[model samples]
Target: MTNSEWRMTAKRDKVLSVSAPVPPEQSIAWPRGKGRALLPLANNSDETIRLHLRGEDPDSACQFGFSLPGEANKSSGSVTLELSPGQVLSLPVSITPPPPSLLGLAPQTYHFTFTVINLSQKERAWTVMGRLKSKPIIGPGLLGVTGICLIALFVPLYRFIENRENREDAFSATPAAEASEAGALWPLLNRGVEQSAPQTPQLAPPDLESLTYEAMFKEVGAAYNLDWRMLAAMAYQESYLDPMAVGALQEMGLMQIMPATWNVWAPKAGVSDPFDPYSNLQVSATYQVYLREYFSGKGHPGNKWMLAAYNWGPDNALQVIESGADWGDVPLHVRRYVLKIMQTDSHPVLSDPRLQESVGGVRE
Candidate 1:
């Protein structure tokens, strides 16, 4: 009879799927934990038969052996049985039945005698084998597969729940000190000043300056916390303190605020008319305050660093700060600005009476 004609049966419930051709030698996989199957061997005649089982993965690695029923000694009705990984094989003996031993192992009792062998990496095949004397009682082998399926379904969900609970606890227990410690390596804000008050003494306020211009200064100065003279100086620098001035370079109004910078600061300063001297100065001063805070430092020594930075971007000024050098030690352009202001001017334009009035007066 062909190997396919061989009948195998299990006694207990556990078998998943039985593989007929266990690699190397014939054997079957009874998934671990549950299941058993029986292979029938001899029906009538009893002759010694050979069976072998071997592992299919690695070479000369895993193997097992079994003997069939009624093949004791004289009859020689025994088969060499081997076992491996994928399948199990059962072969019948072709000799006469032997007389029962005094030990009382009826021929059927030795129907299956198998041993498991471990395979090495060098081995490529393995098998499980047994000798069948008479019809072998079989057991179920599919239940082992069911247990594996249940494990796969539950493991991920269990880990997910565990991780969520851990994160919640960590968030609740973190203290302010620990939070600060964690953030110490990464600061919330960089420390530095933006601008410094001019070094040379400011020009004396024009005696009996108009109340309208004074009121305008108060409103603009309050919005930006700026020294009014700085705004006045920048206006003089840009438009010669001319409120109605518009530049050839898209600069407009007193202080010559750029449209882009004006848009960014105007809403916050409550200034609607960008060209209005008071409104423009209010926003411009506030914007200068922003730049001052951005560049100034609590430990930075002088206001000159802020001025130098405004004149020559923060990066260049930072080099001076790091070197602990005075503005005069730096570039001439930057030093010339403060120095020129310090030198008193006797020219008619410097003494003009109508300058501040014209720039500071804003309608509405």
Candidate 2:
């Protein structure tokens, strides 16, 4: 052909066309929902291009969608599309109504052609490339990434500094936890069920007769859901047998009944004396049960930390448990104290002893 005649052929060829997957590729595994197929321009001539999709079937009719990478899509259908040689036109496609049955069926695929039409006189022969990209690669090596990281770190540090400044002026007295005899923080010391604490030498049995222990048992059983043996153990740890015995802190009665605890629970239980041994044991048992429920609900395993909270308070207990401070690491006295509570296995400790009692003392 003459050089001038060559212009039209090159221009026609510049309008690109392709049967996707070529032939023999009938189906394309498209991601569920909306997706796009890339139609790359190949005319090579630096020319403006106009491209559109022309479907073979009547169902394939929609505006030609344009986007970079895999984002271009107008609509999904089987069709032949026309395009300028040096121009790339994206076709939008969607996969709906998942295959009816995979049984005895070959995998499904889709094939389509995109045509690039050169709107202006450009290079001799334009070549187009098609790529189906699901997502664009985000390169962090680019600018602004360092700024994003700095912002993330600064927020938490700012919050911490603000809280510290606020605390300087507001926290004047002994912290809320230590200000009172019935310190809300008293639960921190009770180790509860966590056996991770190091065991201390067991407390010696108290001088009290079995009858006195039994009486202590009945009182705690009547007033609290806690096992009587646990109360008995605490009583031994606190008094050894001295009904009137007091601790170094002057804690009195069974379970080292703290004067603070007495003032708190006595009136609630309608008791006139916090020093009443029966009343004291009963209150302590009730407190233990409350702690058990509280710990179990916070998604923490076991009542160990919960009991510790009872002795110290919730905030202290959370610090110990959440910070991975194993109860075993605490002092021996603390460890032994928690272990004693867990060791009580006698009557009333089994919860519904009737079930065990009926099974000839077999434990569930």
Candidate 1 vs. true structure, TM-score = 0.34
Clashes of 1: 77
Which lDDT tens digits does candidate 2 get at residues 70-182?
A: 33433333333333435443232332323322222233223223443333434222322222212112222222343444554565456545655666778753445234423
Residue 8 error, candidate 2, Å: 99
Worst 10 residues of 2 by lDDT: 355-364
The RMSD (Cα, Å) of candidate 1 is 41.5
Candidate lDDT scores, in order, read 0.40, 0.42
Clashes of each: 77, 43
As a TM-score, model 2 comes out at 0.34
Model 1, 55-118: lDDT tens digits are: 1212222222222433432222223443333333332212112222222222232223222222
